[model samples]
Structures are given as C-alpha cells and as structure tokens.
Target: MPTPNKPDFQPVLIVAGPTASGKSALALDMANTFDGVVINADSMQVYKELRVLSARPDDGELARAPHRLYGVLSGAEACSAGKWREMAMAEIAECHAKGKLPIITGGTGMYLNALTAGIAPIPDVPMRIRETVTAELAEMGHVAFFDKLKRDDPETAAKLDGNNTQRMIRAAEVFAHTGRGLASWHNEPVLTPPENMFFKKLCYMPPRDILYDRCNRRFDLMIAQGALDEVRDLIALNLPPTAPVMKAVGVRELSSYLSGTTDLETARDLSQRETRRYAKRQLTWFRHQMTDKEIIDTQYSESLADKLRHDINQFLLTTPK
Candidate 1:
C-alpha cells in the first residue's frame, strides 16, 4: 500500500466513539494503510491491570501495528487528563518525526478535548496537599471527603458527579495547595495545539439500541474471558478504594460478585446496565462536544476505511490555510 502523504505541521487523526464501537479496529485498519501508529486515548486502557476489562488490544493486534501507551501504568498510579495529554503529545511528535500518521483512538472525551481544544494550566498540587487529601479521603470515605470538598470548593464540587470521588479529592487537593477553586482555573488562558497543526476528527455514533446490545453482549464475553480473574487480582492488591481503577465499569460489579455480595447473574446484569449508561453519556458528549465534526451513525461495514479516507480528504481540502 502506498503511504498517505503527511500533512504539514503535526498531523493527527482522532478516532473517537463510545465503547465497543469498533474504533480500535478502524484505527488499526487506517494505521496499516497509512503507516500510522496507534496511540491509546482510553483512560482505563492505560492501566496494566485492566487488560481484559479495559479491552486493550490483544497480542495479535499489538503485533500488527505500533501501539503506544496501552497498559503502561500500574493501577496505583492515577493518570489525569493532563498527564495523558503530555504523553500523547510526545508520541504524536515521535510519529511526526518518523513520517508516520498518529492515529489516536479511544472513547475518552476529556483526553480528546485536551488534545484538540486545549487545557487550562492548573497549578500543580503540593505533595503535602496530595498526601493530606489522600489520607483524609481514606479516613473520611467518599461522603465525608465530598462534604469537605463542597465546603472548600463548592463550585467545582457542584460541577462534578456525586460519585466521582477521584475528581472530588483532586478539587480538595487543589484548594488545599493553592487556596483556589478548580472552576476558577477554567477562566485562565489555555495551552492548545500549535496554529499549524491539522486535526482530522472521526466519530462513531451508532444507534442507541444497537450500541446498548453490543455493550451487554461484550460484558458477557468479558466475564467468559476471565475478567473476573482480572478483578480478583486487582482486589487482591488492596489498592486504595478511591483509586480510579476501582471505579472502572466492570470492577465494582464483578467485585461485588467476588465478595459474595451478589450472584454472578446479578453482577453481569448490573455491569451491563452500567456499560449502557456509560455509552449513553459518551453519545451525549460526542453530540454536544463535537458538534462540528462528522459522525458515523450507521452500522459499521468493511468499507469504513475507504469512507473514512474520503472524509479525511474532504476535511483537509476544506481546512483553512
């Protein structure tokens, strides 16, 4: 196959969609065609312990293409959007230097937003503040920890989901370190990609019912493939309960089963429900957050690669100089 010509100024191809939408397959096909490197954008896929649950590429897939940043972190290390962006930028630069396409594919809206739009430069939290917050969260639990965050940074707290303990703790830590709210940081000037960089965005927006069905079936497949064992090992590590990995879609549901709190059937049903809900949120985010970009709403087919190539060509042709 003839390699596609690289666009001037770091070129990036973003393939985004809800979970189980075949984004990875599309990315792999494109990479093979264009001498591209597949870089992960899924937050959960970054953890080494989540290989099965996070749906990281299998060994055969990884062998076929150059993949980066998948399963690179231990469960103990939380990967924030900022950290992921920094790592992605480095990988994209490496691909550019080698005259290869950097194809970033995942369902993580925040990570993609950080790459395409930019991110506010939130000040780093002091180690003391981080440690203090971690200790406090452990002692207080989520309810108490959240109450404290509401008191310290109510605006940020209000914006966050009630059960998003990781973010709530982060907000509290920021306030402890800088005496400033995370919401206020949003008003600061953001650091975005350079002016010359060109981004081609492709999103999959499969129908709701079909997407939900896929999610449910995939969860069943996951359990059959020893996802329970993966969760068992994660629980065995006894990482902090507030660790981001603990809240991963299947972990809690499966943990409940393993702990004798629920039956296997109930656990599977609950996990599927959560996965469907997550897919709904992802669709909403893509609809609103990426309104200007092209969305593929139909069923995926073998011609997807050709269709994508044509769409990308159109995007490039219409891009302002």
Candidate 2:
C-alpha cells in the first residue's frame, strides 16, 4: 500500500471517546495508514502496573506501531496533566521532526485539554502538604474533606465536586502552598490552545446503553483477568489508601472485599456503578471541552472501524486550512 502524502502542516490525530468505544483500534488503523506513533493520553495507562485493566495496547498492537508513554509511570507517583504535557510535547515534537503523524487518543480530558490548549502554570504541591491532605482524606473521607475546604475557602468548594478526592486534594494543596485557589489562577489568561494546527480532532460517543454494557462487561472481565490479584499486590505494598491507583474502580472495590469489609458481589456492583459514573464524566468533558471536532455515534457499532475509516478519509479530503 502506498503511504498518504505527508501533511504539509502539523496535523495531530486526536481520537477520543468513552471507554471501550474502539478509539484505540481507530487510532492504530490511522497510525498504520499515516506512519504514525500512538501516544498514551489516558491517565491510568501511564502506570506500568495496569496492563490489562487500563487497556493499554496489546503486544501485537505495539509491535505494529511505536507507542509512547504507555505503562511508563510508577504506580506510586502522582502524575499530573502538567507532567503528561511535558512528556507528550517531547514525543510530539520528535514525531513531527521525523515526519510521522502523532495519533493521540484517550478518555482523560484533563490530559487532552492540557496538551491541545496550554495549561496554566500550576506549581507542584509540597510533598508534606500532599501527605497531610492524603492522610486527612483517608480518615475523614471526601465529606469531611469538602467541609474542610469549604471552611478554608468556600469559593473552591462551591466549584468542585465533593466526591472528587484527587482534584480536591490538589486544590487544597495549591491553597496551602500559594494561599490562592486554583480557580482564581485559572481566570488569569490563555497561553495557547492544546493543539497547534497539527491536530485533527475526532470525537466519538457510544450510547448510554452500549457504554453501560461495556462498563459492566469490562468489570467482569477485569475480575476474570486477575484484577483481584492486581489489587492484592497493590494492597500488599502498604501504600496509603489515598494512592491514586489504589482508588481505581476495580482496585478499591476488590481491596475492600479482600479486606473483608465487603462481599465480592457488593464490590463488583460498586465497581460497575463507579465505572459508569466515570464514563458519564468523560462524555460530559468531551461535549464541553472541544467544539471543532466531529462527533461520531457508536450506538450501531458493528461497522465502527469502517465508519471511522470513512470519516477520517472524508475529513482529510475536505477539512480546510
């Protein structure tokens, strides 16, 4: 097969959708066609510990194309969007220099948004503050964490999701360090958009029923594929419960069950429910963060890849400068 003409301008192929919507397959197909490299955009995919659960590209897929940043982070490290953007910028520039397309795909909107449009310069929270807040969150849970934040800075609490512990801690950490809520800093100004003409955005959404089905089945599959043991190993490390990976849907549920705090069925149910909620958040993010992209429906997904191929070709043929 002949290669497509090298795009004269930077053209990033951003393939994003809810989980299990064939985003990876579409991205791989496009990479093969355009001699592209697939960069890890999913937050969980960054950790080397979650190979199957995070759905990192399989052996055959990685053999076919070079994938950057997948399974590279230690599970213990807190990987912020700022860190991801730094790594991805280097990878993207390398791909551009080599005249290869950089195909970016993931469900993590914060990471995607950070790269496509530039992010505000947020300082890293001090380790002492992180440990302190993480410990407090463990003892008090998110409710108390929210109460503390509301007392410390009511404005940040008003804007934040009470249950989002990860972000909540980050916000509190920022305040503890700079004495200013991140919300105020965010209103400062724009630096650049995530993409620089190089990105051709392709957004997709599976219907609610389909997405829920995927989330449920994937939960079962995770159990079948040793997700329990993975959590077992994680817990054995004696890391704090507040560690990000320790809170991943299946991990938390299974860890609870293993610790005899809950039964297996209840754990599985809660995992499925939380995963569905995560999917909903992803859908909302895509709908709001990006405007220029085309949205593809995967309700009738029997022809998903074919439809995606057609869309890419069509977009390539007609999209203007």
Best by lDDT: 1
Per-candidate RMSD, Å: 3.5, 4.0
Location of the lowest summed lDDT over 10 successive residues in candidate 2:
1-10
Off by over 4 Å in 1: 1-8, 123-131, 134-168, 178-184, 313-320
Task: Report the lDDT tens digits of candidate 2 across residue range 1-321.
Answer: 122454544557798988877688778888987778999899888987777678788899999999999989878776778788888888988887797878899989888888887788776664567888778888988888889898887777898889897789888888888888878767767445434354678887878788889899988988898888888887777765555666566787787899999999999999889999989988888988876787887553447667666766655555444
TM-score of each model, in listed order: 0.86, 0.81
The per-prediction tally of clashing pairs is 0, 10
Pick by TM-score: which candidate is best?
A: 1
Candidate 1 lDDT by residue in tens digits, 227-300: 99999999999887667778899899899999999999999999999999999999999989874577888887
lDDT of each: 0.86, 0.79
